[model samples]
Target: MAQLAQSITPVDAVVSRMRALDATLPERDGVAVFNRVYLAVTEEVDRHLDAGAFPDPEAAITLDVRFAERYLRVAEQGCPPACWRPLLQFRRHPGVRPLQFALAGINAHIGHDLALAVVDACRTLGCEPADLEDEFDRVGDLLISMEERIREDLMPGPDLLQIADPLTHLLGSWSLERARDATWSAARALWALRGLPDLAEEFCDRLDAAVGFAGRMLLTPLPD
Candidate 1:
């Protein structure tokens, strides 16, 4: 337990792991698409930590590492939560746009994994979600800031027919702000349910399935 805690406690090690993923994963793969987005966020968090932006840097590191580890674990184990299954299943579909892949991955991570990550951090630190609110909001803000860039960088070019693209409409339907807000609520609810283990597990499972449904929608393969 001590070694496991130590492994994920350092921001540098987490960033290194992400960089390694970026190096190894194929560019067009769905997991790779999400990894790039997540890697950028992790790198930004590292910068913020260096600049003393987080009031509780250790808590922040714990949350970030714990959150990322969930995703990495899924990749290694091939036993992802419901929220991530769609993205993984559709990763290689040529019809799924890069933008769709990125958004679906974000949906799974933010919608499902993030709530559980909050609970994981609280358990690790022997604290509560309220204690990590500042860090949560800060990390969320970084993710929100990156959403625009993700679209701009990944979206199909503005060719004549692309103006009326279905991907454009699909992308518009989901908002990072909404996802972040929902995650906060889910985190708080999960924390409240911590005393009731069975209930909390059921809630988490439901959340995972709901997020997976959304991911499936996001990955609706559009004709090229």
Candidate 2:
């Protein structure tokens, strides 16, 4: 069994870990509870991959990438960077580093196009003019961050072939399936909540983009 490096402590585990410590809940406070659940789910996903419990490794990689990209879109565009900081910190896990490598490889192929698409989608949504600039800011930040991390941190030795191959393999596995599930969930989440009809359409469009990207991993050439 591989020793796990990072994990969200279970509620029971936390209480046990702080056996002698006293803790109290604040009035109507749900933040701590939500935080614990979020961490637990993240660790569960990591451990699921670590344990090889996913039905297919190849599909898992694609799904993971799609989900991560979708997440980055939300983080850098919709949510404040500070809201994303903690999740980004999860990249410290070794399992996560490879996922970033895989993401970089995918972005190299479609980064510019998808980014422009996202920006266009923002306009269709009639986002505040300030928000349009914010999205661009987020995009620039991501590009810079990716450049710095891939070189200075993630892979000390540049081995594109090694990085790309495993990720490709994993994308063909169950990851893609999970990726599909995520998009479908996105469609569900956007129902009437996004406010703008055009924006909601674009939201589903992006979700379909995710699904279509995953389907490409199917290997059989589809003729136009």
Candidate 3:
């Protein structure tokens, strides 16, 4: 298990793990839904890396691997951060929409795990968050683009877009752009607090709780 975990650093290896997970999960499983979306995004990132799209491929790979490991951890172990609890807890609830599951997972990932991934990459590369800014922005751009596509593909048609539709309101309530910005801020803040472990832990706890609250809201079951 330790060896397998260590071997997950390569993008191809991580992609394989996600693919295997995708095969095992039912189509409607909340974790599977998010995993499918994430797998596509990661594949795209791999393509970008192969094409030399990132200014520093090593840094990009490190960050991407570190970021992905968090989600993979949740799949391997039932344990997850507070921000992810709602999605996993309500994975099969009939009232929850697929789009809600995807967005809630994204909220947990971007709002919590991403900041830590940045710090992880920085520590591994012996650099600061600022040094990886370009890679971060590019990766973030891809996630934002994927999110736009997810909305278009998962959002209900116009007939369901009436003013009274809760899905519409729910969709409006969350913004990937806002989440991305906040994650970047949180990453820098976390990096600054690395020297103070106690304070850092407190900040992380608060962030986990706050993001979890948002995710819980996102996963609210809607009426048919």
Q: Provide the TM-score for each candidate, comma-separated.
A: 0.93, 0.26, 0.94
User: Could you tally the backbone clashes for each prediction?
Assistant: 0, 14, 0
lDDT of 1 at 89: 96
Model 1 misses residue 2 by how many Å? 19
Give me the runs in candidate 1 sitting further than 4 Å from their true place. 1-9, 160-164
Query: Relative to the true structure, how large is the alpha-carbon lDDT of every model?
Result: 0.88, 0.36, 0.89
Candidate 3 root-mean-square deviation in Å: 4.3
**For residues 1-224, could you state the per-residue lDDT of candidate 2 as single tens digits?**
12323343232243332221213322112222222322333344445545655443333322333333443354235441222333233323334333333332233223222333333444445443233333333333334444434334333255565645554464335332233234234433453345677886666556445533442332222121
Which residue pairs overlap in candidate 3's backbone?
none
User: Whose lDDT is greatest here?
Assistant: 3
Model 1 clashing residue pairs (backbone): none
Alpha-carbon shift of residue 45 in model 3 (angstroms) = 0.2
Consecutive 10-residue window with the lowest summed lDDT within model 2: 25-34
**Which candidate would rank higher by lDDT, 1 or 3?**
3
The better candidate by lDDT, 2 or 3, is 3
Worst 10 residues of 3 by lDDT: 1-10
